[model samples]
Target: MFKIMIVEDDPKIREIVLENITKWGFDGLGVEDFSEVFNTFIKYEPHLILMDINLPSFDGFYWCNKIREVSKVPIIFVSSRNTNMDIIMAVNMGGDDFIQKPFSLEVLMAKMNAILRRTYSYTSVESNIIEHNGAALNLKDSTIIYNEHKLELTKNEFKIIYLLMKNNGGVVSRDKIMRSLWEDESFVDDNTLTVNINRLRKKLADIGLDNFIQTKKGQGYIIL
Candidate 1:
């Protein structure tokens, strides 16, 4: 089942939305700690987010931008602020849609369904970017951007990082990586894999992402 996370601060609204989401046959999560919104997002990895503009600690826009740094998950701004500028800013901040406050639950569900369908229906449509921990790897260009600095990757480097980032937060065994490389027609022995991994780590460190990929001894590598 698709999981939807609600980031609204209002208890009443959050409760109502959660109830409706359950009725709509989707799993729902509500954020209780506004201070740890981003961390919560990382842990839940929800398919969609419902964010309110006026949130504690940080506004919705701030959290949205932060989340966008590491994910392309669809976000919808549900707020009382209805200015044209608000709508424009919402779109600019990577929100898929904006819903004014006091919205009908039915309409909210409809918009959510539409976005979910468009985003998840086509298996062939892959996002050209994969992001984690403030770094974005561009699949189209074989480059990684972090802290406003961009660095190009060699073919092997790109393939390794791509595989790791695609499985971020999970251990990718050495054997699995080698098999992937073999399937790509670039056969590499164990020693070569170590060299490539070291090189990639150096490049990532140069871009200020030190220890981005962690070694799970007796297991393999992982990007957390």
Candidate 2:
């Protein structure tokens, strides 16, 4: 079942939303600690987030930006604010959709279902997670996690990691990596591949996982 996280401050509203989500055959996780919402978010790893604008320690905008840095998990702002600027800001800050306050539960469910369908229906694969050496990469969204530090990666970077991790403990040649990337999508030359590998290595190092990916000299790269 898909996991949905509700981050509303109002207890009554939060409960009501969760109840509806449960009734609809989804697993719903309600936020218990407002001050540590990010920690809770990392723990739950919900497929979708229902965020409120007026949070306790930090507003939804702040949390949205934070989450965007690490994830592309679909976030829909559930706020009382209906101003044009609020909606625009929410979208700009990585929120997938926004619902105004006092909305009917039915309407909310409809929107949620629409977003869920639109998000997952296009994919042929059911599972998108790839894990190696305590690092997990979400192929669907290009998000990576290691030792609780999350990072969003570019398309080429994601492909590179996916290839290496899939062949963990095995060497993947540079030419093979280039062939895996789309030729028409972008012109990935030898230098471009090296740049992506270096950037990925730096990102991994920032998360306390230095040298996670190893070089095999002329052979290629490996994650041993």
For every candidate in turn, the CA RMSD to the true structure comes to 4.9, 6.5
The RMSD (Cα, Å) of candidate 1 is 4.9
User: How accurate locally, in lDDT, is each candidate?
Assistant: 0.88, 0.84
Which model scores highest in TM-score?
1
Which portions of model 1 show Cα errors greater than 4 Å?
Answer: 69-71, 123-154, 162-193, 202-224
For residues 143-201, could you state the per-residue lDDT of candidate 2 as single tens digits?
88775577888887888888998886789998888888756435655787788789989
Best prediction by lDDT: 1
lDDT accuracy of residue 127 in candidate 1? 52
* Model 1 residue 161 distance off true place after TM-score fit, in angstroms: 3.9
In candidate 1, list every pair of residues with a backbone clash. none
Error of 1 at 122 (Å): 3.9
State the lDDT at 175 in candidate 1: 86
- At residue 34, candidate 1 shows an lDDT of 93
